[model samples]
Target: MQKMAVLLSGSGRTLDNFHSRIQEGSLAGEIQVVISNVKDVLGLQKAVNYGYPAFHAADNDEINRILADYEIDIICLAGYLKLYSPPEKLKRAVINIHPSLIPSFCGDGYYGNIVHRAVKARGCTVSGCTVHFADENYDEGPIILQKTVEVGYNDDIDTIATTVFAAECEAFPEAINRVNEMGIDFFWDRVAK
Candidate 1:
């Protein structure tokens, strides 16, 4: 089974979801460590509660060291707020789940409720989530999987967020499974020159 590491900066909803999947044998992996960028976040508490090695690290070098020490096979950014430019050696192992479809309501300053608000304000009829390879830029990398969710005409940001998050709960694990099946070589070949 692939050993995984999760990075988060908010509520541990996504992390919890992953843990549930892992425990249920739906996901072919184990979460070896959880890292948060800030202190007192629920994500950290969730990690601790689950008996996972959890820490708060603002430095990329320290984060990289942790990943190496754990021999993590894949790095999942659940709700990590900071931009992490993975070193070349680790690039193929890093992935992130974005709230909105890439190249849409994504990029810097687009996260959490902010992304949902943008989608609702645009009067969009469709919105969804994307899981993709993590690179130096925000939400710019090879797309692995995307799942769309319909936006009801009267749906407010909160409603839309709830709907999309549900989709995310499904999509993220599916994407991770696909990535695992693809193997690390698939990502290595697609890495930018």
Candidate 2:
């Protein structure tokens, strides 16, 4: 089974989703650790509540050391706001879930509710989520999976956000499952072109 270490900076909704999927036998992996950049965050509390090894660290070196110690196979950024410079060996193993279709309402300053608001401001007819490889840049990695949701004419930011989040809950785990099943080589090969 793949051992996952999640990095988060806000509520643990994504982590909670993963746990539920794992418990239901849909995800073939276990959360080995949860590292939060900020203390007193809901995500950290959830990790502790779940009995998972949880740590709060703002230093990259310390975070890297903790990741190495856990022998993690996958690193997931679930609402993690800080920029992460993962060790070279972990480059291909890290993935993040973005709230937009990517290359759209994504990049620096385009996280959380901001993305939804952007979509609304642009009057987009469709909006969704993307799960992709995590690179040094924000949401600029090769897309692994995208789940689109229609944006109704009257949809407000809250409605759009709710819709996109629902898609994320499904797409993120499916992307992880795909990576686990096909291996990283397949992912790289498919995106190489």
Best-fitting candidate, measured by TM-score?
2
Name model 2 segments beyond 4 Å from true: none
* Structure candidate 2, residue pairs in collision: none
TM-score versus the correct structure, for each prediction: 0.94, 0.96
- Please write out the lDDT profile of model 1 over residues 3-45, one tens digit for every residue: 8889998899999999999989998789999998888899999
Worst 10 residues of 2 by lDDT: 184-193
List, residue by residue over 1-193, the lDDT tens digit for candidate 2.
7789999998999999999999999987899999998888999989999899999988778789888888888899999997788888888888899999988988888899999989998999999999998787888777889999999999988899999999999999999898889886677667655
- Score residue 108 of candidate 2 by CA lDDT: 87
Off-target runs (Cα >4 Å) in candidate 1 are: 187-193
